[model samples]
Target: MTTLKSGDKAPDFEGVNQDGKKVGLQDFSGKKLILYFYPKDNTPGCTAESCNLNDNYNAWLEKGYEVLGVSPDSVESHRKFKEKFNLEFDLLADTEKEILQAYGAWGEKNMYGKKYMGVLRTTFVIDENGVIEDVFKKVKTKDHTNQILKSLNI
Candidate 1:
């Protein structure tokens, strides 16, 4: 439930990636960034979404975009997830949920009639200048690359 929309300045964020490397919005300066937030590491929806993106990573690069996945999972968890999926993009370990909260990606979620706080799956398409170009709140997990490409009309 992010309030940020297309044309807004993307929130500044710094996170540790799967390789224990610091990654931030500034690192993507002069490049379009696909910043995605998900709930967990090995879940079905997350896997589908991530795999779809990974499967088409080359196309995204050819079109001038870098992808970054973020989750509340630990660095170790992210590492395993990436390795298992052969993901080419970096996955950020937001254990503290700091970046998630900053982007409004962490909030109340209801499941099975119970409410709990969790990651709100969302993606922000940021431009080279750090401005958000698009926001996907209802991502079609199994075909995310096409979903994003279609929305951006690329």
Candidate 2:
């Protein structure tokens, strides 16, 4: 449902992390970023996706990539989730969803035969130059790190 595509310039984003520290696209100018947007903090899918990323956190860093997750949850919620999952990366609290909308990660969604507005499970592989290298709209939560690695052939 997003208009963003590979090779396109990544839309700028800024939000507070679980620690209430400001984070933005400009912060990772010389490294790749795995910017993922999820629906909630403790849901099954979201948790699996987050844990998978955290499990391979060092791999991403070794390769000069940073992982950042965004959700409409509050900083308190994010902090708890991170502590529960032992996640080392930052989880941005995008309560306003401005970053979500800019990256087209928020839109119409369907569940249990009902439709509503929600966050779309999406990941943007942004290159060092702030260009989108790839976009994963069909993320495999349980094995997302491998999914991305296989997709990008990295």
TM-score of each: 0.98, 0.97
* Candidate-wise lDDT, in order: 0.95, 0.95
TM-score of 1: 0.98
The runs of at least 3 residues in candidate 2 whose Cα sits more than 4 Å from the true structure, single-residue gaps closed, are none
Cα RMSD to the true fold for all candidates: 0.9, 0.9
lDDT of model 1 at residue 58? Answer: 95
lDDT of 1 by residue, 18-73 (tens): 99999999999999999999999999999999999999999999999999999999
Taking the tens digit of each residue's C-alpha lDDT, what string does model 2 give over 4-90? 999999998889999999999999998999999999999999999999999999999998899999999999999999999999999
